[model samples]
Target chain A: AQSVTQLDSHVSVSEGTPVLLRCNYSSSYSPSLFWYVQHPNKGLQLLLKYTSAATLVKGINGFEAEFKKSETSFHLTKPSAHMSDAAEYFCVVSDRNGNEKLTFGTGTRLTIIP
Target chain B: GAGVSQTPSNKVTEKGKYVELRCDPISGHTALYWYRQSLGQGPEFLIYFQGTGAADDSGLPNDRFFAVRPEGSVSTLKIQRTERGDSAVYLCASSLMVGGRDEQFFGPGTRLTVL
Candidate 1:
């Protein structure tokens, strides 16, 4: 079974400070990892994805994640946090095989302090 | 141009009632999916459709949950004998194609409240 675990349920960071949201995944095969963000009353938006290509994947809104195979981690990070970055983040995993169903982590709510 | 869209942004129903949620995928998207998200939890997969056929429905919690994607464009999820536990947000997503790397675009989701 492929699954993802988000280390923090909530993360608070001041504006202009660095941000880190940790995630760990478990999969039998080489899995596809993704980070998604959801704002209040909005849909889930794709942040970044790792598909066995480069370990470091950059996404929209100045977000990025690194896939670490040895550590089974794909942590999302940003150099600086903005008030607009406050949202719920989810770490997702899917089988590399054609099955596109995603297994999502509980989620981490990020609060950007202004 | 438009992302996935779901109908009935909010629905209130009583127990033992039947409810149907609709989803319209992006134009030309070949794959659609349904997921349920409870408060304080991530979305849980319910089913997947490729074209007009259901490729996988294993994630459905019970037989009371059923979905159809006829004509390969619009989809509907039907639930029978709704329970209070079934109250949650139902999300729909679509992808250009079914692949490991394909990104699934999500809808705003339909919030179902069972009384």
Candidate 2:
């Protein structure tokens, strides 16, 4: 079975400050990881994905995540936080054996202060 | 140009009643997925369909939950004897492929509230 764990339930950052959301995963095969963001009353939007092509994956809205095989982590980071960055983020993982089903983490709520 | 779409943005039903939710995937997407999200929790996988067949139904909580994608495009999820615990935001997503590397595009989700 595959699973993902988000280290933080909530994270708050001031505008223009750095932001980080930690995540870890356990998978039997080579893992395909992803980050998704959900705004209030909206569906989830894909942020970034790691499919073994690149360790450093860049996403929309200045977001990026590094896939560290050694740490079993794929933590999302932003150089500077914006007010619109406040939303719920999820870490996801899928089995490399062509299993289309994705396992999601509990989620981390991001709050950006002005 | 169309994305995944789900019907009945919100549903309120009494316990013991049956409910059916609908989903329409992108024009050529061959893969569809269903998930349930409770308040303040991550979405839990329910089922996955590849083409006209269910590739995976292991995440289904019980036999009361069932889904079908007969024509390989539109799908329906049926829940029998609805319980309050079944109340949640039911999300539908679709991807270009049935592989792990494909990105899944999501719909607005149907918020089902059981009373």
**TM-score of each prediction:** 0.98, 0.97
lDDT of each: 0.95, 0.93
**Per-residue C-alpha lDDT of model 2 across residues B1-115, encoded as one tens digit per residue:** 5888999999999999999999999889999999999999999999999999998999999999999998999999999999999999999999888864667999999999999
lDDT of 1 at A35: 95
Worst 10 residues of 1 chain B by lDDT: B95-104
Cα error, residue A109 of model 2, in Å, equals 0.4
List candidate 1 segments past 4 Å from native.
A97-99
| Root-mean-square deviation of Cα positions for candidate 2 versus the true structure, in angstroms | 1.1
Compared with the true structure, what per-residue lDDT tens digits does model 1 show for residues A1-114?
A: 899999999999999999999999999889999999999999999999999889999999999999999999999999999999999999999986534899999999999988
Q: Which one wins on TM-score?
A: 1
Q: Which ten residues in a row have the lowest lDDT in candidate 2 chain B?
A: B95-104
Candidate 1 lDDT, B8-104, residue by residue in tens? 9999999999999999999999999999999999999999999999999999999999999889999999999999999999999999899645789
Clashes of each: 0, 0
